[model samples]
Target: MKSFEYLRPETLDEALAALSDPDAASLGGGTNLLDLMKLGVAGPERIVDLARLPGLDRIETLPDGMTRVGALVRNSDLAADPGFAAAFPMVAEALLSGASAQLRNAATVGGNLMQATRCAYFQDPFAACNRRAAGSGCDALGGANRGHAVLGWSPACIAVHPSDFCVPLAALGAEAEIAGPSGTRLVPLAEFHLLPGEEPHRATALEPGEIVLALRLPAAAAGFAGNARYLKLRERTSYAFAVVSAAAALRIEDGTVAAARLALGGVAARPWRCSEAEEALAGKPATAESFAAAASIALSNAAPSGANGYKIVLAERLLARTMAAAAAGTPAEMPALPGSLMDDTGEAAHA
Candidate 1:
């Protein structure tokens, strides 16, 4: 790892000031940043540690009936918070479905949001990657890219954002609370991540000196609590990144869908929210037919960027199954394996 100056700021102002340096990078829990540093994928001249900053680690309910989650709140803590888990069960499930318990214990909400894509090309310093170095060619385009993006990809970059937490958050319409040199502002979680249109290097909406302070979920998001699910399909049963994942939530009234929220992960540069599918679900019966139709609509615009055409079919089926599971109602208790498919006896199926 490259040597760098470390600055532990006791206040947000100090942290923002330290980040004004063009070569400075913010450190949250260092779960992802540390690994990237070791791989030489990231080498910052200065590290502005936000660990000492106050008031960025609390979880509170706002007066406007929204739940505010501190950016520094640990992933494990957020998933384990009874109030948060009860209010946003799908979000909790997504958190649990992420990395191992030890990593989750150290991973903060902000770190997870800012985590880089798990593209092999982007991680290899010697490889050509537009995301890693703009104007440089993309080797993943002609290389091993079976796991690359199937939606919202361009010739410049075909990497997907690998965040399970952000899928459900995008579905629930969460908002990011950002603090910067220009002051504070709120940005919708769906728009926080930028697509790789041409500037693949600019991955997020954050400015040079901006930092995400927290994430807020409106109270209406809680209405789908009883009927929400996050399902993920990975190459392995554990400690693996998702090949495809879906977060589905529906508010059903008298066997009809009153409202719906759906988002897909591991298929795009951002958590792909299916607004059209959600609209199609409204006023429709909470049945397999309705879910299948919605799922089709969700993947209507999806096209494989490389040899990953299978992902489109897989994603469509997964979304339909996920919506069906949501309509079946959320499990009373979180599954032994949070995002895994369960058998008839309510046990997680090894398959």
Candidate 2:
């Protein structure tokens, strides 16, 4: 890895000042940043370590009843928080489903939100990638792109966001609290990630010198705790990036869907929220047929960016299955293998 000047800021102001240097990059858990640096995909001239920033590792319920998750909180810590897991089980499940135990233990929430796509082209310094280098011409466009994207892709890029945690966050209407030179602001998590249009290099809504402070889930988001599920399909049973994933939640009243939240992952530049699908589920019976219709609507506009047309059908079926699992009610305890379809049977699918 290229040598860089490292600064451990004592305060948020110090961190922001350090980041004002355009070549400086913030380091949280160093899980993703370090790897990118090693691969030579990213080599910032300076590193501003945020580990010493105080009060950014707590999980608390705000005065307004919203759950506030500090940006520096580790993934494993957040997933294992009793109150947080109970209130937002699907979010917890999504976190646990990602990476391995070692990674989850060290990865911070802010870093996860800032992670780059796992697209091979972007990671390979030798490949021509629009996301990695503006106007370089996307090699993935005509290369091995069976897993590129099925929605919200442009000729400039076909890479998909790789965060499992963000899917549930999008479904539950989470908000990101950002701190910058101009002070703090709240942005909807759905808008935190930008879709690749003509500029694939601009990935997130974060401005220069801005840092993610925390993520807040509104009090109303907890209402689906009893009926929320995050389901993922991957090449392996564990420790793999999702091929397609869905976060589904429903508020049922008298066997009817009173409200619904749905989002898809590994298929778009951001966690693809299915607002139309959620609207279709309202007042409908909590049945498989209702879920199927919603799923169809969710993937209606999804056209493959490359050879991944199968993802559209796979995403639809997975979404419908996720909705059915949500309607069945959350399990009393987290599954041994969270997000595994076979876990629904209350038996271990792998040794």
Candidate 3:
């Protein structure tokens, strides 16, 4: 084991001071950070614990219809909040569809937003991964890339973001509240996460020592009496990383779509808001055919890998099914799909 220094800061200012050092990192829930550190995928000389920071875990509603969620809020608590359930069912659904109960209880909102990708190559330090070592070359590009990216990829990296919360946040037009040594600022959820180009190490738009304080979701769209769906298509049914997931909020009028917000996960380097799919759905009849067509528009630009070429087909079917279910106002069971990977616990791995 590698030796490291640990500091528990009583205030955000103290934490910021520690994080000012390039070799120091701030720990929120330590769910992802600690695992990566143990695997030698991430290393920091010193770790600043922000658990003592003031007013970072509160959740409240604003005068507007928007919900303000603190960065330090636990995933389990966030999902169970009555206000969150009433105001943002999509967000709640996304949270509940994530990891096991234990993990959800320990994971924080800030850590969820800042969590690294689940790429097999990137997680295992023994493998040659560009994300772990600069200019080492991405071995995932040609080896076992079934669960990697199909969208927003670059020559340097093709790993996908692994945040369930981020997908719903993007579809709901959530904004991030950030504080740093300089000052505080709000960034749109779409712009908060940086796309992979040449720099795979740089994840978010946050500058050095900047910390996310809260997430502010926008007011309701024109519609949504109870019409929103977050669908995850993973290898298993539940408690697994998504293969090609989608979060869609639709406004339907007279059996036609008036407006829509569609965001995709597990297929892109970031939570991909499919504006083209939204545009295609608008002014079109709310039918299975229309949903399928919209999904086609969403995946038109997808660049599939050698092993994951089937994602394109799976994504379309998942999108169509989710849209149909939402339109019908169906409240599905926790594990709805039969033979789902979510149910394949301790079973033999499928080839």
Per-residue lDDT over 21-98 for candidate 3, one digit per residue giving the tens place of the 0 to 100 score: 988877889999999999888899999888888888989777986668898999999988876665666677788888
What lDDT score is found at residue 319 in candidate 3? 68
What local distance difference test score does each model get? 0.92, 0.93, 0.79
Off by over 4 Å in 3: 221-225, 330-351
- Rank by TM-score (best first): 2, 1, 3
**Residue pairs in candidate 1 whose N, alpha carbon or C atoms collide under 3 angstroms:** none
Measured against the true structure, the TM-scores of the candidates, in listed sequence, are 0.98, 0.98, 0.92
lDDT of 1 by residue, 1-351 (tens): 999999999999899999999999999999899999999999999999998889989999999999999999999999999999999999999999999999999999999999999999999999999999999989999889989999999999999999999999999999999999999999999889999999999999999999999999999999999999999999876677889999999999999999999999999999999999999989999888889999999999999899999999999999998888888888889888888764211221111
Model 1's alpha-carbon lDDT is 0.92
lDDT of 1 at 102: 96
Those runs of model 1 whose alpha carbons end farther than 4 Å from true positions after fitting are 342-351
Report the poorest 10 consecutive residues by lDDT, candidate 2.
342-351
* Superior by TM-score: candidate 1 or candidate 3: 1
Deviation in angstroms for 279 in model 1?
0.3
lDDT of each residue in 1-351, candidate 2, tens digit only? 899999999899999999999999999999999999999999999999999999999999899999899999999999999999999999999999999999999999999999999999999999999899999989999889998899999999999999999999999999999999999999888889999999999989999999999999999999999999999999998999999999999999999999999999999999999999999999999888889999999999999888999999999999999998888888889999999886884221110
Error of 3 at 202 (Å): 0.9
Model 3 earns a TM-score of 0.92
Runs of candidate 2 exceeding 4 Å displacement: 346-351
